[model samples]
Target: MGIEFTALHWIYVVFIVLIIGFMVKRRDTTLICIVGIFMLAIGATGDFTSSISGVFNSFIYAITELLSTILIISIIVAMSRVMMTSGINEVMVAPFTKIIKTPALAYWTIGLLMMLISWFFWPSPAVALLGAVLLPVAIRAGLPALGVAMAMNLFGHGIALSSDFVIQGAPKLTADAAGIPVGDVVSASIPLVITMGVVTTIVAYIFLRRDMKRGTFLLNTVSEENEDSTQAMEENLLSIGQKRFFAVLIPIAFILDVMAMAVFKLQGGDATALIGGTSVFILLLLSIVAHKSEGLEKTTSYLIQGFQFGFKVFGPVIPIAAFFYLGDVGFIQIIGDHLPATSHGIVNDLGVGLAAVVPLTKEIAVVTLTVVGAITGLDGSGFSGISLAGSVGSLFGNAIGGGTATLTALGQITAIWIGGGTLIPWALIPAAAICNVSPFELARRNLIPVVIGLVVTTIVAMFLI
Candidate 1:
């Protein structure tokens, strides 16, 4: 509590506000984040060249920290691309169409399936995995394209990604910033994620149904376009039998990996490694089987596609993440040992400092973190600012002397629910595009339900804390 608040701290705080402001204005935060790193470095070391080098160093540190996440997502995307192009994905999702006869059945089935697939591969790849194949089927059954987009967004990006039980990327980032165990964050998130997912999806469905009765949602299949795309993708490199074979084998292999994770009690990096490895194997197997004589070249091509997707997804996140890292262990590494002797990292010290000045309460902490998380998420990556949430949660937890994990989880839920594709038009692109719906319309449809869910989820998190 006696930690000195230095120019470094003030600089960090100012930039945090600037970062949030930039995000709110829908401007790029990359330049500000870089400027922030330099500012902090210069504030700490009082040298020009050192500040310059520190900016680059922070980038290296951020990229190094983020490399594993990038690799896993890339590998999964590559696997998904091959599945989608090879016709295996078509076969894989065919069974669902038979069960999706009614509108209600179609909505729930598609949502649940998307959630399940999202848990394993995460949402982007999950979209690539089966959304295209399932969209027309659900649409034919009377679920509007917007409704399908909602189900996929709420379940896949909202629920699966928020909990991130399999990938653990979300937990790892928050946990590291909060200085807590990944297990604590993951365990604490379960009830909150469930509450949010259930409430939001149900609310969204309710509104969707009400509108359906009025025939508000117009049905358009874009079937010809979809078929044309499919025909173009079909090089017929894979026989129907081979397509069917992979359609069966691919799920089985991933299922086994999931089983192995459970059997070994694997989490975080270990679990991510297992998933990434299996994806690589699947990608290789598919590329070889589908491309035969040119399999090697095809494999590389798929990897390139995957890497492109991965970097594109994460590229916006890196700079912001780098700037936030300095609030934790990254401080000493990037800017040298310049913090006050009593300082317990910038974020931790801020927590202590705040607690010392204010009469902190769980209620206030809950609302503050919820807002901070949502504000940070205005960037729409949902990921770029979770470290800030973790930092702030850690801060408040220190002030209150408990509930770090709960607060961190709450922040994660809020941020991801807001910007992870549910209410954000741009973030909704994958599901929207796949379902042939307007992303803005999808976002508008999601707003009420998501807000209701966030309110409910925050209350639940309050009780947990």
Candidate 2:
């Protein structure tokens, strides 16, 4: 039952470590990944020309696999831009300012509201919408910009995205890789996700409050710059009626979309498509309403801007993701069809090998899966690692008796929470940019709370499983 590590496998392991090392130093790993891909290709083909071709093909394959996610994000950003320009985004949060009267209320209110919005429209768009709207309110209500950033990051990216109960994209990714039903993963993840979310956000809020009391919570230079830009953007000329109409219209449209999703039982890609398509339509509608005579040009302009933002965010991620994809189920497609017939995926093989080598009791299985999930998340794309987590979960489950669903859910939660946005500076950019704080600062603030949350969630998962 012993598994031998092939040159490809060994190379994969080495590159993963190098990538983690680079990430730890807060360095860019895109170039390192491309080089790793070349070396991996060479190991597989032993032909310089073929290796070069394989590298290109691997990038192409990664893009193909990730196109849906990229497209949805782009479309949502486009929709948000349209809302912002129309002055609707401002109106969207006007109602909330009434309830968020103090810093404590502002923190929890913004965090909970962000969590809800992120569940439906996704965190990318939610950040854009809320940053333009709620962030200013939070700041005006005596919350520091960094505190605002932490709340938004933890709730939107950390909690909503990690659970992904509404879109079910994360669970689907894990389930598909494990060859299990998505419902099983989703059902099992709910408790763990809630535990992580509640604990992390509460702990982070307390830290924020402590900082405020100590007078260490003054706004940084970045916040002043962001505030000035925000004020400039807010100086828009719009009829009151137009703003009111859109503020109401946008929420109604999203509410209907959610209802439709429930009625249709749409999950995963279908659900994303529903939301993305609705966003496009809303963008078009708002553009036309805002610029009746020049709507055509305006719509195109908004779309062009959205695509630019989307591609800009995704550019560095593609290369890193391509390198990791090769170690998972996508290897045969990325490399060549002629990979050894006996070859299991690099990660899958490693998981099985570990299960064989280690004495895995229930506690050990939980700890191992949690560690593996966290390690896989180092890529800063919470998603790319889930397949590995799922595969490893299955292997471990088979080695033991059962609880594959619980283990898979635990791994999924840990991977998404760590890499989805909380701990990774690169991944925290969306929330950081919106809150106008340094991504590194936000990551640092989130580190303790998230780590504690993950540990508690994993421990709870042990009993649940």
RMSD of candidates 1 onward, in order: 1.4, 3.7
In model 2, where do residues sit more than 4 Å from their true spots?
Answer: 2-7, 39-47, 139-142, 166-185, 210-228, 231-238, 337-344, 372-412, 419-444
Return the top candidate by TM-score: 1
- Checking candidate 2 for backbone clashes, the offending pairs are none
Model 2: residue 86 alpha-carbon error in angstroms: 1.0
| Range of the 10 consecutive residues with the lowest summed lDDT in candidate 2 | 229-238
| Clash pairs (backbone) in predicted model 1 | none
TM-score of each model, in listed order: 0.97, 0.84
Superposed on all Cα atoms, model 2 deviates from the true structure by an RMSD in Å of 3.7
- Tens-digit lDDT track of model 2 for 1-465: 545678887887788677767755656677888899999989988899988988899889867865766777677778777777767777778888899889999999988888988886678778877875677777778998888888888999889988887666677667755657788888888888889888999888888889899998774424566656555443344577888887888788878988997898776678778888888888888778777888889889988988887677567667766786776666777777535566566766666666677777778888978987897677687875675577667767766667788888888888878888888898999888877778998899999999899889889988986
Summarize candidate 1's per-residue lDDT along 1-465 as a digit string, tens digits.
468888989998899888878878878889999999999998889899989999999989988988888899888888888888878878888888899988899889989998999987779878766677787778889988888888899999999988988878888888877878889999999999999999999999999999999989887845567546555466597888888888899889889988998899988889899999988989999999888899999999999998998899888878888888899888898789999998989988888888988999999999998898888778788888888888889989999999999999999989988888887788999888877778998889999998899889888888998
lDDT of each: 0.87, 0.78
